[model samples]
Target: MDYYNGHEDFLDRIEKLNAIGIALSSQRNAPALLEMILQGAKSILNADGGTLYLASEDKQHLIFEIIINDSLEIMMGGTTGVSIPFDPLPLYDREGKPNNNMVAAYAAINHKTINIPDAYVAEGFDFSGTRAFDRKTGYRSQSFITVPMQNHESELIGVLQLINAKDPRTGAIIPFSEQSRSLAESLASQAAIALSNNRLIQEFRQLFESFIELMAEAIDVKSPYNGKHCRRVPDLTMMIAEAVCKANYGIFKDFSMTEEELYELKIAGLLHDCGKVTTPVHVIDKATKLQTIFDRIHLIDTRFEVLKRDAEIEFLNQKLAALESGNPQNVPSLEAKFQQKIQQLNSDRTFLQKCNIGGEFMRDDLKERVLQIAKYEWVDTEGKLSPFLNENEVYNLNISRGTLTPEERQIINDHIVVTINMLTKLPYPKNLRRVPEYAGGHHERMDGKGYPKGLTREQMSVPARMMGIADIFEALSSDDRPYKDAKTLTECLQILGKMKQENHIDPDLFDLFVNEKVYLRYAEKYLHEYQIDQVDLTKIPGYTPPAV
Candidate 1:
């Protein structure tokens, strides 16, 4: 019997040795290191309850950190799901002065293990207001063993506490063995080293998020259209990426991206139009068909004055005829004719004011009349007759139609290039290296017609394509737009489908998109109920109503 007992002790010692080795190997990350220690300690001391407390930088009082009991109810004391404020509480001095129960302080200040044989009967221990903790929680005041986790350099890391190490079969708590205390203190030392490394990484990540916010805001404040675009794009981009991941689209099935990568993609979407910072606001918010700074309808007024002068000549000729006939004809008067012509011209120019308010289309002939009334001859502020617009400018002005000029179109396109330039110059995280590529590629067509780099279908990432779609969708459905009323859902989708058919978009992605019902998901989330309610079935060209 004695020989058998000796063999069992040897095996138990080996098991504990392996456990400590496993815990030490977990030095790669702080949280993982702490969890490993908890798991190891639970197995080592055979305790049902365990808690790990990280020391504050100042090593004052120990605060509640992570609890790993089977019930995990200790976290209910209100530390879960909150960022614990980093405040150092005062620690008790070894000479019986009040000291904080922080593991680092206990280990560093006392340089010894704190083992309570019976917490309920312990003298000179402060259980003061924490009695409520025991009463409400049903946690008996029994034995506890705490040790400071430290590194080889004697740096204080954190504190580890094990509660109720019990005598098996008797179901009674027992004080920790000296050997167990030594092993735990050794483990704590290893954990301290891990904690320091983790804190450094966390600080770096926070700094990165701050930079992202500043860059995103700078891009937003630069343009009116892009003002709220940044905020909305990130929200929408992340949602789409999540949906795409859930859909398990091909190679992405096994492709697991980290949270940092996802964040980078979102930032890229937010600053996709950062180049707009260089774009003039006047051009971005241009309201007129041929607008630069101001529409030249005033010049059209000059043409009307010319026409008024011609009418005066004709009126005088009529008066001369009456005089030649020797008939008494009172001249209708010089100023009267001039005033009449001015009144007619003013009426024509002012007739279309309310018409463009809600995008009320003019009759073809009437639109031409409005255009003729606007065609005026005038010198610039420089007193020079500007060079007559060429065919391209005339086409953009679309006198017969109505919309932005071609020069303005190029100016808008240049914003994407600017976006690329601005982002590319900044040193970003590795995952966000593609920010400029994705943002600049938004305007590019799948068929190689896109500007800047003109990346084709295969060159684009899923995120870039999704951002493009989201951007178009938002613009189409935006009721706050100055020119056009928000298009109904059906109208927007049909336009998107047509663009897809024209080889401007990814047909395969579009098919998966409609098949997976991406747009419906987006509509339910971002768009208003009325917008969805107004989706006219008939307006979706070639879409037949399903049989009920």
Candidate 2:
């Protein structure tokens, strides 16, 4: 009957150990896992208190990771919001000798467990600090079970120390049983494996996030004008996404994002412009209509100077010919003609200079004049007559909208396609599978007229649509773009409202944007002081202020 009773108790302990192992395996958080490990050992051995110490990276010291004392009602570290102020215990003495005097350090250094029945009378180990702690707390320090936490490779990762086991029947301090020590050692081994796995997973996550940010930085570095674009877009995207999730009444009322989803969206935003790295710098930074490797306007200026010099030379030759023919009276008329020619040339030069700049709109008459200027003749370096503006130059100067020519605009727009292709090739996990779709669809429009895939508002996901609004708003209000100055908050809202009216963007989102003042919040964070102008909500086209 005695043997059977002992066997039954052993089976009960084994069942508890199995349950504890399962719990440890499921815990992904490191601090919580450590706390659980210590708690499991204490419960198994009926220990009144415990401390878990993790070995430092250098393997010379064990740092206090978690401490729990049920008798003193003390709990520090491990999500308690209370910190351990004690110093780390060293595994070795100053002379590089193993510190076998300390029970916990001895276990870590020698790869063994130290089960002391009575710490006060224990030999060959230090208990001075433990006794001091007991004196301060007016509590007796007795039995101790120190277990070394070793990984699968038998590497010492940490130490688990439990103190003052209690007799269940008498409720008196007692020595930990041989069975209790065995259970603790087993628990420590499982805890070590769990902790190691959790740390490895967390390290991989941090490395992946850091690598994403690095790629975003690399894209920004390729163009000075877009230095913070990759960073700011994610901020705005999250802002808008969060706002959508908060709307109480609308199509987005039921919208919500989990923590993982939010993280995935943020990653997508960071990588949205990554393909811009492949975009030609000349096209990306084309500040003016005539800008390429350098501002070709300077070359045009030199041509104007040549034209003036030639006119002067012709005038001097005509004056000398009039003198030789005794027809000096015609010289004044000739001089008047030369002056008029110079004046006309100066006026045309000024006009061409003005046309070289990029603006929101370019009139047809201005485009016609650019073509006319292209027909003008100039003497080339090879002494041959050439059109003052070549075919490519004329096409560039006649750009109807922003600085980019049709071909250059196509090149710039191709980044979205490249972004899709690049991201699609990546072996993303299930949670991040939508990254390519979200990143690639930011440039798509509401009316099925947008780029690459021409995805309409109905076809795109809500997060992708949110990114589109963010991208447009950021571009409109950003002072960093090379081609234009930042628009005021008022101007940006008005343009966005007009886009809604034209079905260029989601009307519902635009309404939510204005009604919620998402733009104002973003302006306070990112926009310049001058750009944050007062906006009249009533005046914004197609935007009605929400009734208070």
Q: Give the Cα lDDT of each candidate.
A: 0.64, 0.89
State each model's C-alpha RMSD to the native. 6.5, 2.7
Residue 165, candidate 2: how far off, in angstroms? Answer: 2.7
Q: Least lDDT summed over 10 consecutive residues: which range in candidate 2?
A: 1-10
lDDT of 1 by residue, 306-385 (tens): 56666677777877876788764445564476568768766765654433332434456765654554454434447665
lDDT of 2 by residue, 289-330 (tens): 999789999999898888888999999999999999999999
Q: TM-score for each prediction?
A: 0.70, 0.92
Best by lDDT: 2
Off by over 4 Å in 1: 1-37, 54-62, 70-113, 117-121, 128-142, 148-158, 166-174, 177-179, 189-196, 248-260, 289-344, 347-396, 399-404, 425-430, 511-530, 536-548
